[model samples]
Target: MSPSLEKILSEIEQLTPEEQLTVMGHLVERVKKHITQVQPKRKWSDLKSMAPYPLLGEDAQEWVSRTRKFADEHREGLQREE
Candidate 1:
């Protein structure tokens, strides 16, 4: 262990059981706060490289048109049912 960590442990050891518990709780809260403040770093290039398939050109346009048509038909069917 690092000297700083060893020193902290020694200081913790010097406390009474109740005081140690309080110190432990405070440390846990501090660690939780620190973890929450940390954010994962990502790049757009990295994300794009990981895509299963590229989205470009005629296929994407056709897909969007087909989806809109399907949604319109489904909504009309639901209205008829009501």
Candidate 2:
């Protein structure tokens, strides 16, 4: 850690628990403000056309049907064993 941060931490340790919490709250708000100012807000629409249709090489409905059929067959096999 940097010497400045270490010095600040030593000072914080001398404060009461409530004072420490107050300091923490201020720090958190400052960081949140910094992040909002520096980062761009993202939108779901931004992902449009990023992936090709049949994203995983198959239609989504077809994949769901195939997966359900598989799970049903697996469960039937387990039932037979039971």
Candidate 3:
């Protein structure tokens, strides 16, 4: 639709069928590399789906609560020290 895209398509069309196929393979590899790069970002969602999280059940909740309490109790002291 755009001039740049149309120009690229025109050039690609000028190539022989075999050349086009080779170029297509290179593009596919580049796309696969991009997908692999983005895979790590799904780790948080994956953690929820995977069984046996590092911390689990009541222990995790209690740890979170205790951490919150500690943060709250020392809030003024921590802020002043910083």
Taken over the whole model, the C-alpha lDDT of each candidate is: 0.87, 0.95, 0.84
- TM-score per prediction, in order, is 0.47, 0.49, 0.44
Off by over 4 Å in 2: 1-37
How would you encode candidate 3's per-residue C-alpha lDDT over 4-82 as one tens digit per residue?
9999889999999999999899999999988776443555765675666544655777898999999997997888898
Best by lDDT: 2
Model 2 TM: 0.49
For model 1, residues 1-82, the per-residue Cα lDDT tens digits are 9999999999999999999999989999999997788677977777765644445534777898999999999999999999
Candidate 3 residue runs with Cα over 4 Å from true position? 38-82
State each model's C-alpha RMSD to the native. 5.6, 5.0, 12.0
* Candidate 1 local Cα displacement, residue 40, angstroms: 4.4
- Error (Å) of candidate 3 at residue 70 is 49
> Which regions in candidate 1 have their CA more than 4 angstroms from the true location?
1-17, 26-40, 54-58
- Compared with the true structure, what per-residue lDDT tens digits does model 2 show for residues 17-46? 999999999999999997777567889999
- Assess the local accuracy of residue 69 in candidate 3 as a C-alpha lDDT between 0 and 100: 92
